[model samples]
Target: MGTKTPTEADILRPIKNTSTTYLALVAIAGLAFVLFLIGWSYQLAEGMIVTGLSDWGSGGGVTWGVYIGAFIWWVGIAHGGIILSAAVRLLGMDRYMPVARLAEMLTIAGLSAAGFYIVVHLGRPDRMVTSVVGHYHITVHASPLVWDVTVITAYFVLTATYLGLTLRYDVTRLRDQLPDRFEPIYKGLTIGYTEREDAIVQRMVWWLALAIIIMAPLLLHGGVIPWLFAVLPTYPTWYGGVQGPQFLTIALTSAISGVILLSFAFRRGYDWDHIITDDVFRGLLLWLGFFCLLFLWLQLQQNVTGLFKPPVDVGHAAEGRLGHPVYLTAMSLVFLVLSYIFAQAIRPALFTKKRAAVAALMVLTATLLEKILFVVEGFFHPTFDIYGATPGTYFPSWIEIASITGTVGMVSLFFLTVAKVVPVVELHAIEHLQGDDHE
Candidate 1:
């Protein structure tokens, strides 16, 4: 018998059916998030001192630590995720169509997680309102914090609008087949829908995709986020023009890796082999390799300039990074993944979905470590020696550590919940595949 064809029913399986494994995943994710909340609450009660983060100078420590690092990591993932989706649409990369919506959704989850990190790192939640919102007019020009908040909020709105418009089309066409329990959501999504609006919506989406693509390198990852650190002359490790491209490459690599892992999970859990296809995985892996190469190249550029015939401060920052085991491990992981990708490209038989997923995992881990070290070391080796000695050692307290797990759990739950409410895979993808089958 020939292989079976996928239909809308396949896309709607999670919405209509329940599984033991699904429930188990939900339980685990929920528990992790709850634990994070508990840790956060304890921090709230005991104060920011519990996080082990301290002021610089006389305090003999860095104010920013894992929280800021993780914040940047999450922002990169979010920015890159949307860019991936936008590229698929604007560039007409049909092979990646199946994963486009997944990337868009990842943007939403990632931005949400990043936003939460800001709130968590603020020490007091009210500071967000008082320090950011209340003082926005005065600080807007001077504070990178305000710039960071403004850009993130703007991008979040853009991504949400883009996702919402696409969802309207999907929800309208699949309304009858969708669960009535979610009818209100579907109705709200398609409130002003009509078949006559299809072409117009497509055009709107196209324009939006174009906008996202244009803004990515200029405004999102490559711009504001890296600029937050890059313009600061006090931090030798972070202050440089190269940060723009370096941050963009890392964002793309991390985001692509995230999409690969999510795609693999859904493909396995929903038996969506025909829908997602191994070909898609191969293409994604190739893209991952491309970005990883850029990421490493940028690192080399930074290291060489800082190490060879460099000023005193630059040499110290470079030496500190080169001497760190964490930095070495991160670089090694990316190199290994890159090598595997190249080897697989030469000999297709070497490629396997499991291996691809593993490669993605390694890249994600590598990027996270690289980003954390970037933030920590920037503060660790600043030009000014206000402390008059080495700043006291720093490590993330248990609460700080728990925040990572908690944010991850939060993202997991977002996927789990959203999957149940709507088709994670786009309806157009199914129709396109069906058309190919018919031909």
Candidate 2:
């Protein structure tokens, strides 16, 4: 008659069990990813001209389009995901412990998607090695593209190390119950593990969390990614001081939205109602709302400055953004989601996980649209009028469109594969819950 207590077995369910639904999900995700590969291969054989992108002036169109916008969007999600996880650890936010590892895993998947975008956008993938890696020393000083690559690599390494260290503790304790098929991975993870090192690893993780929190504003989304666009004075739509905070807020909102969607999926699939509770969803929604408010405020600041008796070029860019249907739709979606969040805050009875999930989906869709518009509109109204009377138009080609589905499928597959290898829910979370019950 009483509520059941959660145990390690609950955390390990993904590793120990498989169902028809799970297999079906794997098949669907795999098929989507394969379709993306087919698209990419065609593009590679045909060339960048196969997609919607084209050079400025002569081509009368934008060189960067959905690919670059999606790249920035994915980076924002990755940067914000790590920040959320770091905050949970550094601030001792025990209530969110259940989803901390989920956030970290999201960071890994997001960065991979972002990196993939860079390679896809390059046309010739080998240029990544020759232009970026081979010339890092020279490019690091002058190239924002190189800076973007550098920071992403650094963040990925840090997050991977942070994840590996935590897994050592869990794998060691649960080795007996774990599948022998993954014994090699377990051995490598716990190669030098000992109970005495637990305290040391905790200290190291704490410092890593602190480092991540600090680097976010200085080196990640708030810094390098926006700087890529912000420093380009030729592009009136992107040039300004407002970009840093604007990008940061959008990153946080987008990342929180992603976490909400992911948490909902795992909770439903694993029946983790008790672990990732309704209360956790409520808290996450509130945080998402807060960031959404900041995101809108930043947009207002940019619009006000641009629309009010500004330079001709700046005003033209502002007009383009305000007049765009996609931009209006994106802003409206955010406003609606924010309104629902505010209403729920007043009447807690209004909240439901399904509604929250829907809101998250809206936010994700809005952010993606906003980002793509930001990139396109910047090109549409550049300061230099090299095109003269010629007008530029753009739309995502089928290959470009399939890239999104492919990347989403890839991330989903990453989660599915990782779940079968290790517990997606942290063992520490279960231990913490049990400790609270004892108290």
Candidate 3:
């Protein structure tokens, strides 16, 4: 028999067939969710005392722990999804069409996890709900916290709508091939589908991509998030204009890393090596290398400038970061990985998907550590340093650790569930690219 061409049905196989591995993963995620609930409940019942955070006024201590660190990490990861999607859509990078929807979906999932962290960070979630809902204008306008919430909410809605709109075409195109059980979902997603709607979605998505590309870098990551840290002159390390670009760079790096891992999973799981392609990974890895360089350079800008003159507070903070073994080790590891990735870029023969994945993974770990250090150290050596308080010690409580675990589970669960309902790969993009190939 001639080589069988992969069809829509072939792409939909994951949704139709539930492998044992999938069930096991879902079950484990469910357990983590339960543990997360337990952790949050403990915080609610006991109080903030249960966490490693301490009141700053009484002297010194890390007010934010791993939870906030994880919060920043999750939000940063969310940035990549829409960015990758927007880039592909706006730039007409058809080579990446297969992974665009995956990137968008990852953005939605990452935002969900980030949002969940916000709720978990609140000792009393119900009060925050009432407070925000009841006094939206007063609170939202007045506080950076509220601004973060507002922008994140807006970004989530925009990304979700962007995903939903584009989804209409794919779901409608593959409707007949999908299992009957998914008919209702297909109906809901593709309500009022028409050939004209195709052009309409493309136009809308193009504008949406443009808007997100502008808003995400300027408003969300670079704008509000960095302001949250940079505005506090009390913290020498954080209080600077550099915060915006720094946060944006790390967010892109982590987000690209996330996309790499997700793409690898689907490509391997669904036998999509041809569609996903080595070229896709190669292109993404190059971008990853760029961000990695940017991340390191930004760190240099922040550190070298501070160390050049070395004011008391700046010198103190620098000593804390540079002198610490963990910080040194993480930075060294990131340098090594960045070097390897650059080498691969220079010598294409040196590049392999496995090495790219490994580099991405290391970057994720290194960045996560860097974020935690940034948060904890800023508080550890406050600009005021009022209480004669020394930089405080912090080890995440069990609750915090469990919550992080739960957030990871939540992201995975979100992707896995959505994959079953919709095609993980974009069908229309596939048709377009396949047609071009045939021609």
Candidate 4:
């Protein structure tokens, strides 16, 4: 007999199944999250001194360190995740349907992590409510930080609402088989939901997807986040117009890499090889290579132009940006990964699941390191150096390290917990696949 077509039960197995392995993973994640909270409490007690972060050009210290770097990394991942989902919906790319919700879940987790970093960076978390949220007088034009908060908040809500609205359709369809305990939740989700309601939902979701696709590349990363750095004429490296596109390209690269990793983990745990097939990996890898190339090109654009006839500040900054050992290593890794990806594309036999996964990991690491370097270097060497030409030193403190680990753990815990309740893979998408298979 030919391979059996997977049914709804197969997709829902993760929801019903219980295993010691699953519990162990959840326990680990919970522990990490708790540990992170403890670290934060310590930081709160001792004050921001416990962190390497300090005022810019003051006390020979750079104001942004791991916290701001992490913020950028997570936000990049969040931007990329939702963009993937939006593209899938808008383009009718059913080939990627199996991974859509997974990507969407990643967006929520990434955004949450980003928000957590912002809170941790604030040092006085209460002031977020008192200073920003409480005061209505702050205009978007007032500060780049305020602009970042505004757009990030908006993006989070829009993505969360998009996820919630889409889940209603699945909840309604699976209402009968879903656990009785979840009946109330399902009812709340499916209230007034009918088969005919899907048409209305699809239309609404399509428009929302359109809006996000526009907002992500144009407004979020390309607009506000980059503006925070790019608009500063004092920061020679960051003052250029290229930061927006550079950030967006790297964001897409990191986002694709994250999705690939999540897809691999879920596939291994749930035995989803058939649904999340080799083609999915191949397609995503191609996109990763495309972004990798764009990122490399942009790096060259920034470096080459900055090096030529550069002002004193730009020349000084370029030396650190282009000549740093870590930066050089990351750029080399990008080139190797991109070359490997292209080689595999030309000769299909060279490609393997493991190879693609490794390439994705390389890209994620390189992008993250690059982002951290950008933040630290930009702060260290300002346009008007108060500390002469020498930049301050920064290494993440234990508190910062713990917070990073804890945020990662929280993201894992979220997905693990959600998998037990909602089907991580979409049933409706699978139904469509089945129909096409039969035809």
| lDDT-best of 1 and 3 | 1
Each prediction's TM-score against the native? Answer: 0.98, 0.98, 0.95, 0.96
lDDT of 2 by residue, 35-132 (tens): 99999999899899889686666787789898998888888888899899999999999888899999999999999999999999999999999999
- Candidate lDDT values, in order: 0.91, 0.91, 0.83, 0.86
How many collisions between residues are there in candidate 4?
0
Sort all candidates by TM-score, best to worst: 2, 1, 4, 3
Cα lDDT of model 3 by residue, 1-439, tens digit: 1133446766787788888888998999889988888888888899988885765556445778787788888889898778988999999888788889888988888888888877877777886768777788799777888899989999999998999998898887777777788788889988888988788788999999999999986888888988889898878878899989989988998898889988888877777776777898988888888888888888888779777877888777877777777677667767887898778878889988788788888988888888887888788776677777466677778888888788888888888898888888888767865676676
Per-residue lDDT, model 2, residue 268, is 93
Which is the winner by lDDT between candidate 1 and candidate 4? 1
- lDDT tens digits, residues 74-191, model 4? 8999999999999999998888888999988998999999998888889999978887787746655588888889999999999988888899988888878889987777787778
Put down candidate 1 lDDT per residue, 1-439, tens digits, no spaces.
1167789999998788789999999999999899999999998898888877866667766788889999999999999999999998888898888899999999999999999999998889999999999999999999878899999999899899999989888888788888889878888888978888889988998999998888889988989899999999988999999999999999999999999999999999988999889999999999999999999999999999999989998999999999999999999999999999999999999999999999999998999899889988988888886767474567778887888888899999999999999888898888888887888
lDDT of 4 at 287: 92
* Number of residue pairs clashing in candidate 1, backbone atoms closer than 3 angstroms, sequence gap of 3 or more or interchain: 0
Model 3: residue 417 alpha-carbon error in angstroms: 0.9
Give the runs in model 1 whose Cα sits over 4 Å from its true position: 389-391
C-alpha-based local distance difference test score of model 2: 0.91
Q: Cα RMSD (Å) between model 2 and the true structure?
A: 1.3
RMSD of 1: 1.3
lDDT over C-alpha atoms for residue 360 of model 3: 81
